[model samples]
Each structure stands twice: as structure tokens, then as C-alpha cells.
Target chain A: MSGLKGWREIPIGGLILDAGNAEQYKTGSWRTYRPVWDEGKCIHCLFCWIYCPDSAIIVEEGKMKGIDLEHCKGCGICAEECPPKEKAIEMVLEGEGKGV
Target chain B: MGKIVALTGNDAAGTAMVQIKPDVVAAFPITPQTELMHKFADAVADGEVDTEFVLVESEHSAMSAAVGAAAAGARVMTATSANGFALMWEIVYIAASNRLPIVMTLVNRALSAPINIHCDHSDSMGGRDAGWIQIHSENSQEVYDNLIQGVKIAENKDVLLPVMVTSDGFILSHTLERMEILDEEDVHRFVGEYKPAHTLLDVDHPVTFGPLDLPDYYFEHKRQQVLAMEEARRVILEVGKEFEKLSGRGYGFLEEYQMEGAERAIVALGSTAGTVKQVVDALRERGERVGLIKLRVFRPFPKEELLEALREVKVVAIFDRSHSFGSFGGPLFTEVRSVLYGSDISVEVLNYIYGLGGRNISLEEIEGVFSDLQGVIERGGVKERINYLGVRE
Candidate 1:
């Protein structure tokens, strides 16, 4: 009953990506790179959050946060503008069939 | 045999339709194109042309009926002018998008807030982006020939787009001229039968025509329409070649008159092209390096061909009968600038808005346009507002 009853209907939240958090998820070949945030060298300057054209980056508790890749076009403007001691934002190659 | 009988442009179009023998003709009479519908009605009454003539109550209904007839897999033809054409605006776009091979004759007239029934390009210009292949004719002969060729071009399997054969209203529609009429048998052989890829009345096939499309598919359909128009450029030339073989007069997408080695040139379309050419010949007799480029096809505008024709000229004066309000530029002038935006050849382009509201464009006024262009060429440029020739101060 536990496995079969719960399995028949997947949670709606899990079935579809949350629209608000979509910017953190990356999909498609058109997106060449996914933004990676480096926690160690990060400063809470929030320059990346302010400059991301897609508003992909979100800031909470006065700290730099990760991007919602689902809605990000992978334009890399945030990666270029990161103001940490070492670049906190870096672009990572997206895996095949991983992005929408 | 060549006939010397004088006939109006509407008569010429109706005569060509008779000779071509289309399956259906739906029209509402509007000046100055009522004669065309009248002649067709007479022909139908006499049992000369075996075709269905639908006399609709309104121009809107006329175009809608034509669209329906075309959808039923019949070769359809219609004619309207000015306000009458404006009335048909909604269905005109549908006729092209639905890919119905309907051929329409638009006797170009000035649109009215003040109500003027005169020769102007406003009617056609207003509907420029309505997705029809627009062809302008310079004279009655071109009008007659274009109507004949329009059917062949529109029905070509590779290019199934609606076509508009436009001539100057009143000026061309009412003017009488001697034109060569092709033998009826030859025209019949040329146009052939109307065979549609998808038809509304085809019960066996049962295809959905003009269904509601969502945004994703709507864009794809428009893209396909664009591809069809680009394909029409080649189809038009091929059709023109076949027509030349049959009729002995060659027509290009753009006709050049003494353009080679000319220092200055005037660019215009419709019946005014003939008038401009006459003026060019006279000026050339006085050793002026002036020429005329008559644009035959306006929509799917012959850009490369136009630039090629005008590349060597130092100054180009565009004579536009229609104005693009609030843009401070004539429609033709805007298109010309867009065509030569990044090109190395920088010919000085000037816009002269003339002959609007059926005002007579005399030879003197045409010469004045050339004189303005001459001034620009001599002094490198001239400062003048959009010169409206014959506009009462």
C-alpha cells in the first residue's frame, strides 16, 4: 500500500520544475555553459545577482546564491561580472540531454 | 491577328479573363474598375466564356466569395479599387495564407478621409504586407499580359500564393488603348486546369483548411509563406520566359530603360513609368545622362535587381504616389534605403511624392523631379522638404 498507493500519483512538484526556480535549471544545446558558484572564494557583493539579464541569480540572507538553470539562456553575463577574490561564478559544460 | 481596337484597362483585364477561361469570377463593381465586372457579366450573358460569375453585394463579400470559390478548387479572379479594396482587407490576407491560388486585379486608387477617387498607390500600398505577391503594371498592355501570367504564376505547384495585378485607377482603368489579345485557344492551353493540392470540397481527401493554429505552428506557417514568396521570385521569371515565348514580349522583374552609363535616374512604377521613360528619352536627346528604372513587381520587392540597375548612377529620384505618414519617408524611398543599407554603392536617394489624389502628373512636373535630382547631383545634395508636386498652397 505504501509503495503502490503513493507511486500511482507522483507529486506535482516533482513532476514539473517549479516556475520560480526554473532559472536554476539549464537545458538544451543552445546553452553551451551552466553557471557554477564557488562557495570558498565568494564574497556577498551580489554584483552577479544585480547584473544577470535573465534574473537567473537570486540572493538570500545577504549572500551570493546559485542560478535557476531552467530559465537561464546561458548568456554568461553573471559569470563575467562576479566580484569574488577568485571568480565565484564559472561556466560548466552542460551534459547531453540534461537541459530542457 | 493583332487588333487595333481601343479598350480600357478593365476591358483588357476582362478580355484576358475571357480568353483565359477561369472556372470562377467573384467581383463587386467599384470605380474605376466597374467596367471590368460589366464586361465579364456581358460575356457570361452572351455565353461566350463558360465560367461562373458571382456578383456579390459588397467588396468584402466579393473577396470572401472568391476565397470560397478558390477553396473549392476553382481558379478564381476578382477586381476592386480604393475604399472597396479596404473593405476586402480581412479576406485578402486569408486568401494568401490559406494558399489559395486566387488572382485579383487591384485598380490602384487613393484612400480617403476626404474622399478622393483618383489614381494613387495607397490602396495597394496599404495592403503591402497582407502576404500577396503584388505586381504593378505600367500600361494597359502590361495589365492585360500580367493578368494572363498571374494565373499561371499563382497556380504553379511550387508557388501557390495569391497574386495582385495592380494598375493606376482611373488613369489606367478608364484610359483606352490598342492592345494585342492572344488567341483564346493559346491562353486556355497556357493556364490549363485548376488542380489543387488540398481542396475544401474534396470529400475523399478530408483535409482541414484554415484551422485555428497556436503560436508555435502559426510562426512555422508564416515561415513557409515566406519561403513560398522567395520561391515565387524564380517562378515569376520562369513564367515570364514561357509567356515571352508565347506572346513575343519579354518582361523582367524590373525593367531598365537606358540605365547604362547614366549619371542620374528616376525610379517609379505603374503607368507613370511610361511617362517617366518618355521624359528620360527627351532629356537624353539633349545629352543628359538620365534614365528610368520601372519597377514591375513591388512586393517580394526586386531588391537585388533594383540595386543592380541603379548601382552606377550617381543620383536616384524615387517618385512615390503614396506617403508613409509619421515616418517622414515615402514607402518606395524607405524600401530603397533598406535595400542599399550596407552596400558599397551609395547613390543619393531622394523622395518626390507626386500625383496623389488623382492630381495630374504632367510632363513638366516629372521634369521638375529630374531637375531636383540634377541639383542634388550638381551641388552634392539639396535641402528640401518632401516636395508635393501640384499640392495647392
Candidate 2:
């Protein structure tokens, strides 16, 4: 978040100053849809984490910690990639209840 | 603290590499440029240097490996000419954008269609806008000297951009020249060690290189590279001064011969400057007031210096060895004319694109160029701006 002034403030190359700090970018603002996860149906296949373009899926200690909404761009990739008979992950409008 | 040596341009560049002992060298063979890498390979085999040589299959892989090595905090060197340089086009921009201080010896040659292995500036000129600090050399000595300074200039924190030292292919690359090579210790001291500001191998402080930047930050990052180029102009002179302390040669944005109180002058680059200087001297002896400006650095184009150099001249001729087809003038001419725009300078400037594809540029052609300048001055204006010299009509 610091030193994000004009283009001059960035380091000489495109070196990211805040190492591994993609969260600061707040990419979630770019999302028009949100993904709701049902832990009950999760097989922990981690397919959503593997498919995430922004690495926005949160995985902690051999268990899925749901989605990291801070960095997720609401691309619906996680829900599309979720593998279950009924689909554990579903996409929904920002103000709407979790869609089927 | 120097010794006189008879060496070709390629051998001299190889000598510089042997002296510097860069951490890694990734290069492939191209005519006129191949011998340089051959010499380096011999150096490595002979244990003259411990440089890690990546024997890449093509110039593209050569440059790609160079980018990887440079990003990993290793000082890297490479060499190529013409088509080979063209092959490295992709990683060339990435290397500069990633702020890797990769030093390259770009043997100037024409691109192919008829396919020739000879001298021309088309190769490097095509790469002129690729964000590398370009320094042209007139001979083997300049090639050697420029490489020594290029390392320091590119690695400087304020700059941190790639630098390419070029000499005319075959004309300088193969021809023998008398040179005063500095003591190995002196060259080593002058080049110093390349300490990158941030590198991939710096595991303690991890860094991402060439990250995708959207509209929110892409424009600003490019602006920083622009500022770095401006900063390089200052660092180049500074590093040249430091190199002068070790070796007697002082490098600058451009080299001026005569024009102290001249009416007309010729602007050129690379080894052709030597030939132009000879013509200038001959014309001067015959009471012709002509001078020459040999552009050494073309990337951080010395506009202000060029304006100052030609301030007293009445008529100027800019000769480019490369052609920018469908354009008003060649790359050098286009940039030079742009700088003089909107200025109050009372100088008539003309552009001449010649010697493409290693065409022989004789002294007669040189004299004819001066005669045309005289014609332009007498007429008080020029009808044609871009003219070719020595081409069959």
C-alpha cells in the first residue's frame, strides 16, 4: 500500500515492493459475482485452488479455508471448477442469496 | 599502464570479456559475431575465465538464458549480429524491462532478404527502441573500451538497464587494428562487480520480475524505465569519468571531430566515423570547413549534446547505414530531426541512408556526400531530405 503514488514511485523494474502482498490490491472490487462454498460437500480435491487465476482460493493445513475474497476477482472460476454431484460451490450476485 | 596489441574487433571484445569474467555468458554464433563467442569459448576452455557459458541453440534461447542468469543476480554477457539479434527480439525488451544489466556486443550487420554476412547498422537500429543503452564503436579499441564502461553504466542503480556495445560487422569485426589494451587489473577494477538492486536468487528478500501490470500501474512502470534512460545519460558520463581514471579514454554521448569553427558537418555512427574523419581532414586541408560528429551512444540519444555540437555549423548531413522503409528518414535521422524541431537553430539538416546490406562505401562516395552538402549550402535550401549514397542509379 505504501509508495503507490505516481509511476515514478514504483521500483526501477516491475519489482513488487510488498512481496506476496496481492491482497493489498483489493482485486475483489473487480468482481460482479461472488462464490459461496458449502464445506459439507467439499471433497478437498483442491481443484478450485489449482484453477484460481489469482491464487485467491484459501487452503490451510491440508484443509480448504474457503475463498480468499480479498484478492478474488469473482471470476466464478472456483464454482465452475468445483467437482461434486450437486456442486458444492455456486456463484451469486453480490446482493443476492447464494444461487443454485 | 597499457600495452599495444594488434587485434581484430571481435578479438578485442573477447579480450574484454576475458578480463571482466562475467558470472554467466549465454550466446550463439552468427557470422562476424561467431568469432567473438568462439574466442570466449576458448577462454573458458583455457580457464582464462570461470564464466558459466550457456551453449544455447539459437539467439532466442541465448537471450532467454541471459535474462534468467541476470535475474538470478549473475552478471551476464552475450553476442549476436543481424538476424541473430532479430531472433533475440522477444527477451531483449523483457531484459531491459526487468532491469537486468546485461551487456551485449552487437555486431552491426544488415538483415537478410538477399542474405549477406556483412556490415550495416540495420540490426541494432531495428532494436533502437527496445530500451537498451546503445554505444557504437569506431574500431577495436572503442569496442574494447566501450564494453568496459558499459558494464558499470548498466549496473548502476540509477540506470539498471541493458547496454549493447556495437561495432560495424566485418569492417571492424574482422579487420585488424592497433589498440592500447589496459592492464587486466585496471579493467577489472574499472568494471567492478555487478551488484543488482534486487535479484531472483536473493531468497531472503523474495522479488517478482516482469509481473503483469494492468492500466492501474503499467503506464507508471514504463515511465520509470523512461526516467531510468534519462538517468543513464548522467551515469554514462560519470562511469566514463571513472573509467578514464583507470584508462586514459574518456567516453561521452558522442565524439566530435573538428566543428570548432566550421560551416558544415557530417553526423555518423560506428566505424564509418573513422572514414568520415579522414574525409573531413582531407577537405579541411583543401580549405573546406567541414567537421564530423560520431555518435557513440544512440539509445539515450544525446539530443542536447547534438544541438550543442552543431550549434556553429551551417549545413549538416546525417548519414545512416540503415533504412526505415516507408518513413521520412532512417532511425537516427528521424530522431535527430525531431530534436531540432521547434528550436531556433539556424542549421540546414539533411538525411542520407546508405551502405545497407554491407555495400561498399568508398572515399569517392564520401567526397560526393561533402560536395552535396556544399550544393545544399549554396542553394540556401534543400529540395530532397533523404538521399542514398553509392547505390546504382
Candidate 3:
């Protein structure tokens, strides 16, 4: 809040003049649980990427790279939708691991 | 000057909408307001106008679609009354807070519980504080004129807020009256082109709307709305002046009838003002110093103008067609009194809650109000702060 614009300086009509500024704000802090992706048990079927509500699943060359935890809301949809056979992703309590 | 034509209030509103030809209109049917939409929709279907008429399932969806279209930077319009307006209540605030210049016709009707489709101010008064400029119409002509002016008022860059132009339900909506309507080309010239400063469709200058405005900046945005409303007072008068030039019909925040040298007066809104005008003329003929201040614009509250209008008056009877339950007085009464509060004005004021649920406030009742004001002056003060008119004992 240190240099936040006052009412006079801000854009009229409460519009965010900068488009796609959502990335500048992180939603990961809102999470009570975070999704953990296992590299070894991965099927790379890309189900987690497809199910992420926040588009937090990072995909490179059409393959799952890792979770973009900065944006992940930890809704457990990625974990819930992961095939039971592979069980590549699991929900863990937030702050359980180092930088989890 | 425009040519004279006979039209009902709904038809008059529809005529204005058809002429303005907003880029988009999302409509759902409701009493009083339905015919206005029908007029616009028929024009769209007949290829008379190129307005995109979206048939929404409900008033909520109607307003949501209107908001979306307006954010995309299209000139948008919609209409509703009573419960339909109530249904659109949530999105109505969203439309205003987002600062979309959407012009809507609110044919004033009673909000439901008993559910009667007739004329009343309950619907529009319910939205008096929703950040939209509220303009009340006395008759069909004003309904047509206000709708045309509303577009310009809402789209004014200095005041880019939604405006709800209201006509009393059924009283004006279903009643035919002779009024002048401008040619489509003339209306086009007056309203001119809508050049939105920022739009979702303007990819070259991208922007976002309806973002999560938390405590950090929510207060600031609301402050912006407050300034915009303040600016609207100037813009509404400016537009009214420009419109007067075109149509020869002058309008202001409030229209004073026989106010000069009057000691007692009645202040009111909507179709009741027309009835009150008749009483004023009758009383004036009988050498009674009674006048009226028919409030044309209510949302901006017209505080200074009202003070100026009521300056010479000693006793005032304010007629509110809607009740503010459990409050000291009706909405108009409280507002008029509040404006005079802490001021040099030492006028005696009274509130008469009248015509609720579309009960007729006849000419005699208006005269009775003036008589009551006369009695207040005779007695030197008010006995009751709030009184009901035209209701059973």
C-alpha cells in the first residue's frame, strides 16, 4: 500500500487500465493446501494441467513441466482429477515442506 | 423543432430508444416497461433500426448482458419495472460501479409482496442511492425527452455513470398523450457518436473492469463515483440546456410552478406533479399563494437548487409516492429537509406519503395538501411531521 494511488489519480470507473495484470498478484498465498507433483509416478497424461482452475499447471512442449505455485490456488482439482493408477499429484498441507 | 405526435409514455420511451438506436439492448419483459422494449425490439426486427436486441431469460441476465456489452464499449440500453427492477438490483449496482454509461428506462412500479402492476415510485426510489443519475418524468413528453437526454448525460465523459430515466408506471406507461418527437437524423446529431475513452474491444488500449476492489482501494473508487455524481449535476443541466435548444422544452433539476411570492408550496415527483400542477393553477386562480416544485432529478438530490426554489416559501408539504418504512418521513421529505438543515432557511416542512401501490392521488388531495400547508402557516408550526394521503383510515 506504500505508494497506492489516491482517488483523484486513479482511473475513473474503477477500471484496471493495465490489462492482464492478474499475474502481478499471487493467489498461492490464499491456499491452505498445495498440490505436490511427483516426477517418478507421473504419467504425463496432462490431466492436472487440464483440470487446474487457475491455469497454474505449467506445460512445456505439450508436456507437464511443473506446477506454477505462485498462481495455484490449491483447490485440489489437479490432485482429484489425477488418474488413480498413476496418482502423479497429491494435496499436502501448505507450508509442510521447505517453500511448499 | 420536432413534430407533434400522440403517444403513450411507453411508446414515447420506445420512440426515443428507437431513434437513439443504442448498439445493444438486453431485454426481459415486465409490466409498464415491457411495451417500451417491444417498441425497440419491433424496430430491430423490422430492420428499421440496427440495434442488437438480446432476449434475456430474466432481468438479472438482462442487466448482466447489458453490462458485458457496455464493457465491450457498445452503447447499451435496457428497461424494467417493479420486481424486475428488484431482480436486477445486484447487477444494477455493478453496472454503475463499473462506470458503464448504460441508459435504462425504469417505468416506476410498486415492488411486490402484494404484487400489483401499476404506477408508483417504490421501484426507482429503491435505487435512488445506486450511483445512477435518477430523472423523473411528469408526463409522456418528459419521458421521451428524458430518455434522449439520459443517453447524453450517462455518456458525458465527465460523468460516465448509468442513468435511470423514470416514468410513473401505468399512469404514463399506458396513458396516451400528445408530444413532439424528433426525427431520427436530428436525434442522431444531438446525441452524436459515442466515443468511449476505454473499452474492452479496444485491443490497442486494453483495460480491465470489475476487478477485486478490496479495502485497500475500494474507498478510493467510491470516492471517484462521488465526484462523478457531483460532475453529473453540471452535465445534466448542460444537457438539459442543449436539449432545450433542440426541442424548445426547458428542464432543470426541479421545475417551479407559480413559486413567485408564494408563502406555501408542495414538492413532489412523477405523474403526481402533473396533478399537483392542476391544483396549483386552480389555487392560483382563487388568489391562493400556493405553488409546486416538481423534482425532475432526484439522485444528485439537487440540494442547492431545491434550497433556492424553496427560499421564499414559509410552509412546505412534500409529497412522496413511496414510503421509507420506520423512517422519520418519506424519502423525498427527508432529503428536502436534510438539504435545508443547518442552512439560513427557516421554513416549516411536512411530509405526506401518498399514492403508494398506485393509489390515485387526486386533484382534491393535492388541494388538501396545500390547505394543510396553509393551516401549518396559520398555526405557526407542524402538528405532525409525516402524514399519509389518499389511503384508508
| Top of the candidates by lDDT | 3
In angstroms, the error of model 2 at B24 is: 1.0
Interface RMSD of every candidate?
A: 18.6, 3.0, 1.3
DockQ of 1: 0.01
- After superposition, the stretches of candidate 1 with alpha carbons farther than 4 Å from their true spots are A1-100, B1-4
- Residue A55 of model 1: what lDDT? 72
Chain A structural similarity (TM-score) per candidate? 0.61, 0.78, 0.89
Q: List the residue pairs that clash in candidate 2.
A: none
Q: How do the residues A1-100 of candidate 1 rate in per-residue lDDT, one tens digit apiece?
A: 2233232232111112123444333443358777877777887778888887777677778876677766677888888988645797787777632332
* Predicted structure 1: lDDT: 0.83
Q: Could you tell me which 10 consecutive residues in candidate 2 chain B have the lowest summed lDDT?
A: B189-198
The number of clashing residue pairs in model 1 is: 13
Off by over 4 Å in 2: A1-4, A27-36, A43-65, A69-100
Worst 10 residues of 2 chain A by lDDT: A1-10
Question: Each model's fnat?
Answer: 0.00, 0.81, 0.86
TM-score of the A chain in candidate 3: the value is 0.89
Fnat, model 2, is: 0.81
What is the TM-score of each predicted model, taking all chains together?
Answer: 0.79, 0.92, 0.96
lDDT of 1 by residue, B270-366 (tens): 9999999889899989988889999999878998899899889998888889999887678988898789889888898888888888888888888
Please report the TM-score between candidate 2 and the true structure.
Answer: 0.92
